[model samples]
Structure formats: C-alpha cells, structure tokens
Target chain A: MNKIPALSPTVLLAVALLIYPLIFSGAFYLDVGVTFLLAAISASAWNIVGGYAGQVSVGHAMFFGLGAYAPLLCYKLYGWTPMAGIPFGIAASVALAILIGIPTFRLTGHYFSMATIAVAELIRIYFGTWDLVGAAIGLQGPATARGWWDLTFRSELPYYYIFLTVLAVLLSFTYLMERHRFGYYLRAIKVGERAARSLGVPVQQTKIRALVLSAMFTSVAGSLYSVKTGFIDPESGFGILVSVQMVIIAALGGAGRLYGPLIGALILIPLQTATNTWFGGGGTGLTFIVYGGIIVLIARYEPGGIYDLWEQISPRRWRRKHAS
Target chain B: MLLLQVIVGGLLLGAIYALFSSGLTLIWGMMNFINFAHGEFVMLGMYVSLLVVMYLGGGPAAFGFGAAFALFVLGVVVYLSLIRYVLRGPMLAQILSTFGLALLLRYTAFWIFSANFVSLPQTSLSGTINVGGILMPIPQLVAGVIAILLTIGLHLMLTCTTIGSQLLAVSEDRGAAMLMGIKPDRMQALAWGLSAGAAGIAGALMAIAYPWSPSVGETFGLTAFVVVALGGFGSVPGALFAGLIVGLIQALSAFWFGPIYKDIVVYALFVALLWLRPQGLMGKA
Candidate 1:
C-alpha cells in the first residue's frame, strides 16, 4: 500500500480545485464541479443523521425544498436579499425536522424511511396545489441584479467558489461531529437504540439534534441550489428522486466516514454528466440503469462503500497504525 | 346517491390495493424482508399483460394469466439469484438490494417501453353497469371482484393447505423446518414466486382501468408500503382490510377535497395510525 501523507492529499486537492477553472476554462467542467461540491455538501449534511446516527431518511428533499423556496419566497414577497433569507430557510427546515422527527423518530429502520417518504410526498403535493407558491407552476427566484447579496451570478465561477466554501464548512462540521461526544452518542444509538437507552444515552434527544443539524445544512444547500438554478419547483425540490440521489451519494461513498460523501459525489456527478451528455437524447432511463446497477453491486459486495474499499486495499499495518 | 357511488368506487379501488398488498405482506411474513421491488413486479405484470394482448391477441383472462406466470418465474429467479445472497448480508444490504432491484426493473421498463403513458386497448370489458342511481365501470368491477376472490383464495391456501403449513414452518424457523425435511430455500423461493405472481395479476387488473408509465411503480410502491404497514407488516388479512380502507379514504377524500388532498389524507392517517400502533392494525404488538 502507498503511504501517502493525509494532509498532503487534501492540500493537493484544494490546490487542484483552486486552479481547475483557470486551467480548463470550460463552462461545462465548472458546472460539473459546482454540482459535485453541492452534492457533497448535501450528502455530508445527510451523513450527520443518516450515516452517523443510522437514520436513513429518504425525505431530505423536504428540507431542500424549504431551503430553496423559503429564500425565493421571502425575496419575492418581502424584497429581502437571498443571503438574508438563508437563516429563515434554515430555521424553517430545522423546525420541520423537529416536527417530523418527533413522530418519525419513534419508528425504526424501514418504517422510519417509509414515514419520511410519505411526509415528504404529502408536503410536495401540498406545495404543488398551494396557489401562493404559484401552485404547480412553482416559484422563481427574483430576477435581481447580479450581485453577491442576491446570490445571482452571471458566471459559474463565483457559484463554484461559494459551493466549495460550503463544502469545506460542512466537512469541518462532520470532522468535529466524528470527534465530539455527540458523535459517540450517535454511534451508540446506531449500534443499538435499546442498548444505548439502557446505557443512559438520550437516544431520542441525540437523534433529534442530529436531525436538526442535518436539516439545517441540507436547507442551506437547497437555498444555494435555487440561487444557482434560479427556479424552485416542488417536483425538483421535494421530488423522491432528489431524496434518493442524496442517499445514494452518501451510501455510495460511505455513510459514516467524513470523506465518504465527497468521494461518492466525485464519482457520481461525473457519471451523471457523462451519461446526460451521451445517452440523454436517446432515452432518459439509461443513466438510471447504470445507477441502479452500481447501487446493487455496491450493496451486495461492499456495504461499507468506497471508503471501506479503500480501507480493504490499504495495508493492514498502515490502516491499523492510523486507526482512531 | 353520489356519496354512495363514491363509497362503492372506493371499495373497488381498495380491493385492488388489497390484492397487490397481499403479495408484499406474504413475502414479509415469509422472510421478514420487505421487497421494495414488489411494485416493479406489478409494473412488469402490467407490461406482460400489454404484450400478451398486443402480440398474442389474448383476451383479458389469457393476458392476466400470462402476466402471472411470467412474473412468477421472474420472482423465483430474483429470489434465487439476488435475495438468497443478500439475505446473508447486513440488514441495510437487504433493504438496498431490493431498492436497487426496483430501480433496475423500473429503468429497464423505461428503456424498453419509453416514458410515454400507455393503456390497454378497450377490450370486451368496457362500458358500465347502472344499478339504481350508481354507475360502475365493468372492467373495474371485474377487477375488484377478482381481487377480493384472489385475496381470499390466497388466505385460504395459506391457512388450509399442507404446502401452506410447510411454508409457514420455514418462515417460523428455517433450521427447524430443515430438520423436519422441508427445504427452506425452495419454500422461500416459492413465497417470492407467489408474491410476484400476485403483484403481476394486480398490475394487469390495474392496467385495465389506468394509463401508466414506467415510473408508476414509485407511486404504487409507496401505496403498498402504506397499506402493508397499516394492515400489519406480515399479515395478509390485515393488508386486505387496510387496502380497502385506504382505497375508500382515497376515493372519498378525492371526491370531497380533490385528488391532491387524497394522498395527504391517507398518509396523514397512516402516519398517525403507525404512531399509535407501531405493530400495525393486524400484526401482534
């Protein structure tokens, strides 16, 4: 196994991303990078509860939609800036997370997942019919002048940097989560909720906190998504596909690991772009076929995901040496 | 009179839901594993019926039977090839494997059938029967009647037959069943076959009344989960009762409030019910 220094790889990656646009000067590549970063951030946020706490929520699109729509709605109704609306978006998403978590967190495993999907779908349907959010037509971000405050950018460069920053912040948060007492509590719950409760861990409280944190981060990503796309529709924002994609990305990379979602996003975003560029015109299902195939193979062969694959291939001596 | 018609319509729809959900509940009971791809099995059944009609010029009975047989074989193949292997893995693996299977089946249908919504050609089962002030569509009435009969038939076969006993024995304890000379693997595979076959029949019945695309499975899948959970995860009769209730609620709500709010009502009630009785309506606590 190669004994590469950890910080060096991260530093090199940062430098590569910093210079990527300047060297390539391609709009498509920049867009892909931005998407990758955004996905990483979303999946990382998902990881706080889903990966660490072992709560497989498939209704995260609810948060994403709230994040995306809250800002756009505030801007349209109250003339507030996108940046100013973000906190409100986060607050709304957290509040929703609590509401949902209080009931759903009582269920375990697949039941919990099913409840999340149902709740998300109910909300999506409600949004679709509500006339205030333009009904099924969906709400659009204000066509404000291009500026940092509005978060509307003429070039993809600024969006890329902003997404990169968000990813960095989320990654740091995940790193802290892994080291903190909260992280231990989450891991304990994941191992066995009954056992954790018997051990005096506040299982429900810990899960609720993790869910709130996860929702807060996911909502931020949603806000950024609307700013970048300039649209907020129930279908795109709260769609089951959106929820499924986040789970797939996090699970594909390695749910519990700090860097798992990043790795997953790195691989999947390119695959998505390439598939769209190639077979997109021919049919819409081919890309999903590939995704489905990858998911099955990964689940059957390596449920621990790409991170586990890395650990397996790495020399035992080195892995054991770095084990924390 | 309109309210009576709505109630009748809801009951009919609920019967179909029960028919499909019975298969899912069966598999869950047999193995304690939820088949996420069960909806795809129904979707495939619809496609199979469509193909039989289009290519072989089969009538409803022929096409329905064809779909059931084809899906039965597919289910057995899936169990032996995928479920058998994944069952040995982690709980997450089992969940995701079926989820993956659902995606694979759905997208494969998308690839072959494209995304356009398709309906079966109007067959001999068209037209409606008016009894008093209520008018019922023939195809839906037939489908609903058959669904109830089949659900009852499945329940009987499970409760009354020797094969049913053996199947139950396997599910109750694989090792003990094996010691008793029952092949748990074969019985489990049979369970899958029956489950998929039921889904196929339900799909064929549904195709008679609805236009659907490849992606329809997602909706049906969610509905099935709700029904299964509400009925009690592994209880067949529970699924039947819950399916009917869900169907009735959907119809009444859609009539009273509009189609959009129907799902919200069903799901809201479902979530609330699960909160109160996590074991489900029929399942033991």
Candidate 2:
C-alpha cells in the first residue's frame, strides 16, 4: 500500500517464482509447480473474456482442445516437432473465436454461456469420433525426445520454466492491457452492454476481440499441456472439466484482477496434488468436493476472491486510506 | 415398421426430456436464475428410486413418488441454504454457486455410490407390451405416459390454480407481489420444489430403462439445458415440442450415423438454432 515500495512485492514475487523450482528440486514439487503454471496460464487467459468482459464462457475448452491437437497432429502427420504446431493452434483458435463469437455474442448472459457449451461439445464429440486425429483413442507425442525441437524432457523442471515463461509473457501483456483503452472498453461492456454501446463502445467487436485474444492464449496453454504430458486425449483436451477448471481457478483467484488467477493457481494446484497423493484413486472425488466447496464459499462470502479479502483486511490498506 | 418404432421411442424419450426440462424452465421463468445443479437433482432422484426399490422392496408407484417427494425436500433445502444467499451476490456468484453445488452433489454421489453403474431390479414395471405390431417396453411406455400427463398437469395447474397465479405474480415483480399478500420467498421456494420434483420423477423414470452412474447427471443436465433453450426458456409447451424434436433428432441421428455422432448432430442443431433465433422456438425476445 505504500507508494515508496509498491513495486517491491512484484519484484519479490518474480524472484520467488524464479527460485521456486530450485528450492523444491524434487520431482513431485516440480510436477505440482508445472501444473500450477499451466493452470495459471489458462485461468489468466480465461480472465481476458470471462473476467474482464464478463462473458462467462463455459466452453473455452474447445480452443484448448484445438491447441492441444494442432501440435500433436503436426507431429503425427508431418513428423514435425510439436512446438511447430503452436501457430496453427493459435490460428485455429482465433478462427474459432470469430466463428463462435459472431453468433454467440448476440445472446447475453446464460444464453451466451450455454451456446458456447454447445459449440464446444459439438467440437469435442467431433474430435472423439474423427479417425484422422486418432478418434477416441487420442494422439500422443513422442515417447522420448525425438529431437531437440520435440520439447520433451525427462524432468518436470523444463516444463516448469517453459510454462512459467509463458505465464510471465501473458501476465505482462494483461498488465499492459489493463492500463489501456481496450481493457477499459472490456470492463465497460461487462458493467452494462447497453450502456457501453450507448457511450459509443463497439460492444460486439470488442467482445469478439477479447474472445480472440483469450482463445489465442488458451490455445498456447493447451499446446504446452500436450507437450508436457506427451499425450492429448479427447477428454483431457476438450472435456467440460477442462473449461470449468479455467473458470473456477480464475474465479477463485479474483477474476479481472491481473494477478488473481496466478494466486488461485498457486493455492489450488498444490491442494489438488496433495489431495491426490493422500486419497490415491478416490482422490478425484474429494478434489471435486473441495473445489465445489471453495466455489460455494467464494460465491457466498467473497466473490471478489482471496485478494479482495486481503484488500479489506490488510493493515497497509487501512493506513494508506486513512493517510490519503 | 422400424422407423415407426424409432419414432415412438423418440417421442417417449422426448416426453421425459420435457418432464425434466419443464422444471428447469420454471425456475428460469420465475427467478431468471439457472440452476446448474438441476441435473444433479435428477441424479439424486435416480438414486432415491434405487434406494427405495432395493431396500423397501417398493414397486414402481412407491419409488416414483418417493423420488419426487425426496427431491422436493432437497429443492427446498438447497434454495434456503445456498441459492437464497447467492441470489443477492454478483452475477458470477449466481452462476458459479449452482455450478459448485453441481460438482459437490455429483462427487458426493460418486463417493457414496462408488461410481458403479446401477439399475433397478425388475419390478412390476418390467415387461413389454405390444401396441399394434410394434413392441413397446412397458417401463418406457408408462414413464412416457406419466411424464406427458404430469407435464400437462403442471401446465394446467399454473394456468388454472391459485398457487400457480401467486407463483407467476412473484416472478413478474417481486416488489409488487410482496405488496400484494404474497411472500415472494415462499413462492420462489415452492417453484424450486416443483421444478426439482419434476426432475426427480424424470430421473426415476429414466432409471427404469437405463443403467447409470453418478456421472449420468452431466449428460442429462446438458440435455435438459438444450431442451429448455430449444423450447424457449420459460414456455412449458415449447419445452414439450422442443424436447420431442431433440429426442427424435438424437434417436434418428444415432441410428443413422452411429451413437457417437448423435450428440454432435443435436448440439450442431442447437447452436444453429441459437444463432438463427436467440429467443428460442417459444421464448419471448
């Protein structure tokens, strides 16, 4: 809250993130770290539209699925490195955003959300049955690194850094956007579409642009996931759970805030891994229960998320306000 | 003959879709709130019916009513405990609360039921009946008939009854209704009960013909959403017609293009429908 040291926390946080893998060099902690970064990437991407624009899309998984597939497909068909598929994934997701956004943006609130779900489900079902992409069996990356470009590695450390780099880029971009006119337009639309339009905000075009940007990042995150796991199953790629996770993580962190999702990922991914370790095979059910509980509590008490609670409770915030 | 059989089956399935979807549509109409956990209510209904049959040695009549009654109670409890609180929160909260409730309900069922698919033991509802030359399974036939009857009954009650009028009044304008002798809370609670009770019965009926696990709710929930949207969000009759169309499309497409593509066909049409008529087939713009 102090003006003299406002930038220190961010610098410290960056330093911590940089040193995290080194401090917890164990495979388990690194795996969780990598997962956290992946979740952070997707959740942050989802915030562009869902958080800022208040679109509440429950089907961003389709873009993630497309992203996951493009790289693997490139490897499967052309014997090229999976990383080479990143642009294709981004392109496809952008195109899909245009296709979906034009029609779906006409509907508002629940209607728009449901329409996105329908489109995503359609894509998932198609992917599940399409033999060219290995149908229900799904596609896999190289078992081991075929070459330097494969992006495959034995340790989780590489993925941690890779995902962290992506998250850093995404967060930096979002930070800039938050201070820009485009971000203002998105927030304006979120407050009231009609009012924003009345004030001369190009509501439809702005929403589509936000969605395109969100989809591009989401696709990249998906590409990273497939690269990390060396697998891309239909369920993992395009499942509703995948989409819901992005929403939940963003909501948990504090949607619309630049660092909300990163914080959410920091807490949630570790909790999830811990639960899985403790509960073993039945851990999934418990994890969902926990996730559900968090969502309910957040909705009931602090919809602004943990950061919002921190703002209210922090002594620094109080002192700063009183001083002003 | 085969096509007729398929059509009949589709209609029967459609009737069930209408049965559950009407409950969802009712909540949407009354409160402008979408209960993402509606399908979880149905899943619980299936389990309720299963429990009644397996433990109490109940027949179809008992289990059907038992499921409905249980879900009605649950509906009221959920509204009072969770939905009521979140209703005052932000739009995101409103959306995510029910979704969270959904995950909670679904996984709890998984924990309790062990994720194994279960079905009712053959009771009096089991058997096949011949209508003309085509054979119709009695469970589905009865389920369909009851679903249609109940949906129609619900429609009439809303149109003709005092309670229905009060409910509609609350939905129209809570402030105005509150000024009148009506307690908006009670009416809304009643609406949830009725909506969930309908879903409960739909689940019980579907259980007769299908093997299901806790995850069954996900599919049924999505299907109910499609039915509700396609029929027009708040229109009961629209739900009926739309439900039939979806069922028929799903059935025919599954039969023609294989089971995997059926959902694709349905969702494609649904998205296209939304694009063409965002208001839905029976909804007011």
Candidate 3:
C-alpha cells in the first residue's frame, strides 16, 4: 500500500529474518531458512532473463552446475581457495552464455531455449558417467578445510548469512536493472522485436546483454549452493527438471517484478517440503499429480502469475479511477 | 557382417523414429508449432496398449492393434479439446499449453501406475529372423513395415483425399482457405488428431521393441524434434529419411564414442545444421 511506503518492504524483511531466528530457536526454522535461501537465489537469478528479458530459458542448470563445479574442482585439483573460483565460475558461465546465445538468438522464441536444455543434460550425463569427478559416486564437499579462505564453514550460520547476502545483492542488481537504460530497451524488445527495431532499439545486442548479465549473477549463486551443500552430482545439478523448477518459480512469482522471486520461493518451497515429509521420502505419484495440476491451472488461468494477481487486489489499484 | 548389422539396426530404429516423427512433422508442417508434450502421447500410447494386454491377456498381436486404434480415438479427443485452439495463437501458447498437457498425462500415469519401469504385459511378437549371419528382430521389422505404410497412407491422405486437400489449403493460407469454404480451425484440429494417432501407433511399436514408462516421452520427443528439423518442417519423405539418418548416427555413435555422448553429438549436429542450413535438408529455398 502507498500508505505503508513501497521501499520499506525489503528493510522489514531483513529485520524479520534477522529476528525470526532469535524468536524461534529450533531445527525447523533453520530448515526453512536454508530452503528459502536456495529458492530465493535461484528464482531471483532466473528473473534477470525470464522476468526481465522474457527469454524463457529452460536450461539455467547449466550455469548452476558450472558454478558448483568450478569451486569444488579448483579446491580438489588445483588447491585454489573457493574465493578464487568465483571469478572462474562466472567466466565459465559467461562463455557458455555466449556459446549458447550466439547461434540460438539467430532465430527466436523458445526453440533456442529448449535446445539449450538438452545441452545441459548432455553435460550432466558426461560428467555423471565420467571418472573425472568420481563418476556417479559424487564428490562430497570437503568438511575440514584448514583455513577460512576455502569458504567452508563448520556451522549453518555462515551459509545462512552468505546466501542472505547473495539474495540481497541479486535483488538490488535486478532492481537497479529494472530501472536502467538497458532495462528499458529489454522491455521495449519484449513488446515486439521488429517494432523495437523500427524504433531504433538494438534488438540483438540488447538480448545478448540481458542474457550475459543474467548468467553472471546466476553463476555466483550456483557456486554458493555447491559450497553450502558440500556435494554435487548429475541428477542434482544440470538436469532439465531443475531448470523447469526455476522457471516455475519465476512464473509463479510476478515475472518482471523486483521482489516477485522471493515471494514465489516462500510459497512453493514450503509446499514441496510438506509434501515430501508427508510421503516420507519422495511420494510416488500424488505429489507430482498435484504439482502438474497446479502448473496447468496456472497456465490456463493466471499466466501473469500470483504476484500480478496480488497487485490487482491491492488497495492502491482498487482506488477509484478516472472514467475512460 | 558389420554392414548387415548396421543396415538392419538402422532400418529398425529408423522405423520407430519415422513413426513418431511423422506426427511431429505434420503438426509442424501445417501448424509451424512444436508440441513440447509430444513425447507424452507416445508414452501414453505405450501405457494404453500395456493395460489392454494386461486386462485382455492376449499377445501384442491380438490386442495391440485394437489398443492402438483406441488410442487414436483418444488422440482425436485431445486435439478437439485442447491442441486445436493453439495452432494460430503465439508460438509460446502452443509450446506451453502442450507442455502442460504433457505434464498432466505424465503425472497422471505416475499417480495411477508405479514408476518402476514396466514393459508391455505380453510379448507376443517374439523370435528373430536371421539373414547373412545377422539376426534381425521380427517386431522391429513389423514396426518398420507399419511405419512405412503409415507414411504412405499419410502421403496419400494429404494428396489424394478431399479432407486432406482442405487441411493443406488451411495450412497454406488461412484467409484464402476460408474464402475457399474451408474451416481452418476444424482442419487444424483434424491434423492434430491424425498426428497424435500416428504417434500412438509409433508408441505401440515402441512397446514391442522395448518397454514403456511414464516419463520416457522426453528423449523420443527430442529425437522427433531433430528429425522434424532435419527433414524440413512440412515434408513427410524428408522426415522419413532424416529419421533413418539419425538412427544410423545414433547407433554408430553409440558404438564409436559412448552411449552417453550420442545424445550430445546429435544435438551438436542439430545446432550446426540449424546454423548452416535453417530450412533443413529437403526444405525449399
């Protein structure tokens, strides 16, 4: 509401996270926090392209996997600190972004996006079956690093703050992007590329720029997840299903909004956890049935997603307006 | 011996690819749309036939054809209710809606049927045909023959039948078709029904060769996409030839490199082909 002031929402949220642990000191709160951080980062990173540029990438897990691997691979093989791997991960993701985006953007729409998904799977499978990362055995995140430079922590609190910081940085970056010149160009292109071209908007460059920036931020977060989790594998990383989940999160949240991804993570991640618990370990069928049903219902009815629905009912939007 | 093995394996695999890709190619040719849920139809066909065999206690031969026929009817129902409306809409709508439908079918199977991989109830088509020191699969031969027949039948339908002409007219130009007394919407629906039915037959054939599970649709769907792209969007013969080439590439690649790399190699080829020639092998300039 305008009465509450729009900018205060984030400040209040930070206060809540910082204080919530103080009030509720249990394993449950920690579980929610950990899960929330994961979803928040993934969804927010996805928004850079899906929400802002509307590229509909179904293969974000590629960057995520690269991010996860860079740090771990460096630590294990080259004996480099995890901090140094951040730039390496970003570089790898950027290279992949260009590799995928260059040829893919030549045409248009979701074909390129869908094709990228298969590539992600290919990489995952190659890694999974290869003896390089111990194959399917999965390399466990090193537990006893000698120094803080490795980015490994003995407690969950360090990870909590790290992801919290990542979430903040991503949100701010996306917020600033939504209000900038490139942002306006992206919005214009989303309307109609040809029309935007007619209006002198550099269509090709703008799309590439959106994707590159999105990939950089997403990679940073992916690295964090790998370190936090302490292990990585094919099925857990660069699979099409993970990409689908990220997309669903972006869609469920308002696509183009600054804070929508966080809102999305709050709703769905909890639902997933509750479902898993009820079934006691990946319930056979009913969960997916409900999940698929929700996707169908949303696709049919609420293409604008839940956040857009919320905005429609807001008091500000509901105020009396001038007649047409 | 190598030549015989490659030839036999490629042909059999080609038949399965042709059957599935025919439906996809037809939809793309007329509609210029790709259904992300396409693989699900094939998966559904497999399951349906599986259930029929389980209930009726007959071999794949006795009830397989009838089950496939029943699935064809369901395909028509799907087209009527869902896929028809999206043909003329934005590309995103068709892709997303079909994806949703696919998810619906996949999860519905998961909910009802266990996910622990089940084959067709009865394997009626058993036995091998050996020729020149190379053993050929009988069921695969049946699948190939049927695939070729369906392709020919589809070709005949498109060229020789009035209904086919109506469908072609709509695809060429919607406004022009309307002027010529054709209902473009209905034609689009019919195209979807026919395509789904073709995929159903492919699925039944697939069950004879291997097995069916709920989520097995994605890999086959990806293969069909490659074939459709390679063969030229609207060309039936192109799809057939392309499917065969893909099967050979896959089989050879599986032997040359590893099975895992085969997918990557083909997709990389698809991307390169797209880059060098977007219209595809048989498409008109």
Give the top-scoring candidate (lDDT): 2
Q: Provide the lDDT at B41 for model 2.
A: 92
Q: What is the DockQ of each candidate?
A: 0.59, 0.71, 0.48
Model 1 spans > 4 angstroms off? A1-4, A281-283, A316-321
Each candidate: what lDDT? 0.87, 0.88, 0.75
Worst 10 residues of 2 chain B by lDDT: B270-279
Tens digit per residue, CA lDDT, model 2, A12-126: 8889999999999998788878888999999999999989998888899999999999999999999899999999999999998998888878766777677777778888889
Ranking 1 against 2 by TM-score, winner? 2
DockQ of 1: 0.59
TM-score of 3: 0.93
Candidate 3 displacement at residue B168 in angstroms: 2.1
Find the 10 residues in a row with the least total lDDT in model 1 chain B.
Answer: B88-97
lDDT of 1 by residue, A143-254 (tens): 7555668878878999988888898889888888888999999999988889999999998899999999999999999999988888888998898778878888988999
Point out where model 3 deviates above 4 Å. A1-4, A284-286, A315-324, B59-67, B73-94
Q: B128-189 in candidate 1: lDDT tens per residue? A: 99989799999989999999999999999999999999999998999999999999999999
Q: Looking at model 1 chain A, which ten-residue stretch has the lowest summed lDDT? A: A1-10
lDDT of 2 by residue, B92-162 (tens): 78888888888889989998998899988987777898889899999889988898999999988888999
Candidate 3, clashing residue pairs? A141-A230
Model 2 root mean square deviation, Cα atoms: 1.8
